[model samples]
Target: MKFTLNTRKVLEFNRILNPLQNCLRMLVSKHELISLFTLFFLVYNLNMRSIISGDTLPTSLLPFCILEHRCVNLDSFGAYIETINNPYMFRQIDGHYLSQYPIVTPLIITPLYLVTYILLKISSCPIDMFNPSFQSIVLLMEKLSASSIASLSCIFVYLSIKNLTNKKIGIISALIYGFGTDTWTISSQALWQHGTVELLLAAMIYITIKNELLENKLNYVFLGFLSGLYILNRPSDSILALPVILYIFLKMNKENIKWFFALVIISGSFLLIYNIYYFGNFLGGYSSLSDGMELNMEVLSRLVGLLFSPSRGLFIYTPVFLFSVFGYLTIKDLPNEKLRFLLYALGLACILEIMVYSIFFWWWGGHCYGPRYLTGILPVLAIYLGLYMNKVSKEPNRYFKFLIFGLIGVFIIWSLFVQFVGAFYYPMGNWDSKPNVDENPQRLWDWNDTQIMRSFHAGPYAYDSRWILLFHHGFGNIYNKITKISNY
Candidate 1:
């Protein structure tokens, strides 16, 4: 065992790979010695942040982004996974919750989860995945999951680009994804948003290829399965898949064909398992848990909020992506075939998306479930904007291309700012990230961490301020002492 580990270390440190090569290193086969080394590096790199999350990082919502001493969504879903596995503690409804959670995200996580569990049990290892008590297994699983999310997103983007355009487009798209702001943010998190969204987008793209472009009707089975999984993630974007499904039915509008039944059965089987077990219903585990169904007179207000809302809307945080969509659309013509196809598809998707988003806006109040709601369609949108870019200046001068790339470069820099700089300096988020900032919704001013800290209820940082509370807890007394002195 000692020799084996020593050899693994040698392979891991053999060379420092560039970001692209480093990200793609995991494709190495399970049986290969080199792959094993890469895996070790991946794990070590993730655990390098142990100071933040007790080695595994909080799977919790607030802490993962903000980085506090807490485990993230484990309680919501991970705990559900645990409860189901523990037979004696199992409640039927609890089991059903696991079965049903828009569970597409959880399902993507299952393989790594199972592997960690198996290793823990097999080797009698006491590695806990959540706390230090279970830190060993949890940390290990998180590291693997993080890498998997990164690697899979790369593959997914490549496939989506390749399917929509060509090999070059695919490589460029994947590179953008690897380096892009949102993808980078999502991937780095110790939570489900990145992995889950990636799966949902991939599934949508797969359906488009299978039903419309590819000649394979048999492939709809995977399409339907992924569609069901898509619903599990954001549920709102599930409507977006209608185009692909409609494509499947267009050829056989009159008949309930054999392939139709196969699609239903294949997708339904997996989903039914989730639904019946999760929500005690055959079809509604995730939707049942969503915040959108209830109707109100002010549903009109919610609708307005959906498009322009501070938190969930497209225009809120990243306005450039929105402008890029606009810039792409206004262009007169696109020169290339692949660019034209991508533009047309994206235009159609965007219009379809707008219609659906409008319909649901009043219902859900703009999906503040993080920025994840709109991210599903980003890959398609990026290509759309890229084409318009080609059209806007049929020829981008070196300076213009540099300017465009540099503006994108600014976004890249800002992306790093949001994650690393924003985390420490901005903490909860900056002024731009706050919701309903103009009218100030909740019952106070700066109702964010600042207001909460200053108020009598005070919450976590009542004594100083959220800024002080944030770094202090992570730093323990050292931060508090410095702040305490600064107080003088």
Candidate 2:
């Protein structure tokens, strides 16, 4: 009778815990949840956000302006603008100052700003842009929002690769994309358009691969929308859209194709109206900047600089991507015919991106770290890396496999270290503006005065002490007070 009673009790206990156990399993198994946890881990590990560009200054403010002032123009921020005097980032349109960069990024991140605005209102925290506390809040929100978008890109990167190969390859490639590329140092740091562009591009690739695996009309529609946004985000890189359009046209059914075109037209119409309203032109505020872009023999030097220069070179900053060259050379050996063709199309896009940027007057991308212009093509490079990894995993010769993996490990560590400097120690030495890189373009190629070397000499924590103290103290106090209350 005693044994029977104990067995019944154990059975009852298990029955009571079954729901909790299943919930835990579901959470662990979900890819998105894992990605979110990874994002938080990266954010917590850094514990600092670097606002490194004047280009993103207007974007940081536009979201708050849209929510509070109910206007796109930066008239309310006139005092702040006057203080900063960043002429290149803003333009006077219709007698009102507005962001010169694409407005879509600001609009995308407006919700986060809205949430911050609401919380401040609830807590009676003064919402002044000039106030240190308010400024800290804005900076925190920018980091979180940008990091979140970058994380989303990594998620898609993993999914795309997983679909192409296997789970191990997917996870490894995603980590490389998330940490070893500019996605970590640049896109996750501030409200740069690159983060949004990356997310859109990664999603496009994921959807393309998913569609190839299982045909779906909805995939075409999503691809079309992303394509429209991608072009709008960076019009100069519109050449990157060729592969996507080709894929849609060739693979999608007539009805799906019609839907795709309709979505693209709709997104285009939105841009058209916004541009016409603000700048009185379809090209929007970028028209003046585009005038300087020309194809010339001088582009050859830029092509070399963009590839190999110490300051702005893609390969210099992120050497892990060099494996992508091997991946491209072995493209013909890929078993999936559709994926192989897609990779070829992407290769063409990457080539065109390099050629187009090389012709631009500001090919070094001005006052930024490490090949910012080449950031858009990183997703393609990451996929290629994944391809190489997949091939390496299947190599029959253990010795050769060990040698290749060892080489990749070295590159990965170096890439991560370079990005670490960019995220934490950039601009500490004032390398960009000491002589102004634009005025002294030769500084970019100088091995003795490389941005990486200068940044390292400056040491970590190179940003303003006042801002750092305010962020830590202000948030730290609030956190402690909350803990006290919860304990009570």
Candidate 3:
């Protein structure tokens, strides 16, 4: 077994690579690992950490209240709320200050806040919500937690598409959902309810698809739980519950159907009880939102604005989703009747969601970037895109397929660019505030001064660098202290 030095080195290199090669082989063969890799990839994009919507401020702090004070109300943070003075996001119910938005998202992310709280305590860093130095850390935590949840949606997207079509299409569809939509810019950048809703919807789709192929009682139970949580997360999205219930009713056996409804009732009871106790209504704080909605002649314009307006247009922000229309039109081509029905139901749900939001006074979704109101429907649209991608994968004509694929590639790139601008450069120019899009809804139609163009003009590096510096400054002090203690 005598060998020269070069041969010994060669053997050492191969030995090191053997484990890595096996790991790579396993990751490629297993869809689960590939999906997890997608999660890490989506979460690590530091450029997205620059923006946090004020709507998420209460959610960012609610987790702390839950962990430290054993309460959902933000009573302890009254001084901080006063300092920020963002009244739209909070509600004064009796004597307690609660989040005006859904509470389930904050409740779900509470464990993440707990982990960060423990780490800060271990590092001897002060945990003050009011401290300018610490506020960025809180925002960072919200960004990371939201990003993680949004990334998980991408995982389910991959799994669902893979089950329906193939691995290649699954990967492409997952990337499109994660990077080419508001999932990256809006949902992942803050503790918006949309991220949680998207995750639930994606999981439900996966469970439904998986159960269709291989029957599972637990899947039905999980689907019902998701449906209930979906209702509590965003009341506007509750329209989707109808389609979900119908799908289960049509497909599941009697025993499984009972299990499904039982879980739904159990999970939904929390919201109903909380609403009754706090707001004296079943809808909780969202009752006020319902009051602001009305059907009028303006509904037609709003419906058009939701799809084509410059500021909050769905197509303007994510044009790649236009293919979903094609997917919907060709739904009859799908072999599975159940899958076809689900797609049609989801399509109708999406339309209803748009119609419902169009009547709301705040259809532009406040100060945030892009079509945030449309975010809840993104998973459905993404599924439609996946369907179209699956069809494209099977296209027999080489030139026609190439042309179609090239067009898709261009749209995807443009969509990703738009989302990148939103993630890093939003609110830089104060386009949402100067005229106040809420006060003057007409600004939404101003093609001359668009949100995307304004964000680009403001530039991403300037805004993103400020966040990078804040993170460095906040974490650097903790790192220095830990190093000093270790040396001691």
lDDT score at residue 215, model 1, on the 0-100 scale: 49
lDDT for each of the candidates?
0.45, 0.82, 0.83
Off by over 4 Å in 3: 1-44, 124-126, 461-488
Residues 1-488 of candidate 1: C-alpha lDDT, one tens digit per residue:
99999988877766554555755654553333344334423532432331122112333221221122222123343453454334331223532322223444444566456543443344344333334324333443454465566556556555655554565545544555444434433444444454566655664565455444544655655665565556545555655555555555555643434555566566657656655544566544344433534444655554444444544344333444654665566434534433344345556765565555544423322212224445556666655444434443444477766677667656645433333321222223323235543345321122233311222232211122332342344234444555666798
Q: How do all the candidates rank in terms of TM-score, highest first? A: 3, 2, 1
**Between the candidate structures 1 and 3, which one is better when assessed by TM-score?**
3
TM-score for all models, in order of appearance: 0.58, 0.88, 0.90
What TM-score would candidate 3 get against the native?
Answer: 0.90
Candidate 1 TM-score over all chains jointly? 0.58
Which digits, one per residue and each the tens of the lDDT, describe model 3 over residues 179-296?
8889988888788889898999888988988888888899989998888888888988888767778998897589999999899888888878888899899888788776888788
Model 1 scores a C-alpha lDDT of 0.45
> Which regions of candidate 1 are displaced past 4 Å?
1-100, 126-131, 162-169, 206-214, 232-234, 250-261, 287-313, 326-370, 389-406, 419-488
The predicted structure with the larger lDDT, 1 or 2, is 2
Steric clash pairs (candidate 3):
none
Candidate whose lDDT is highest: 3
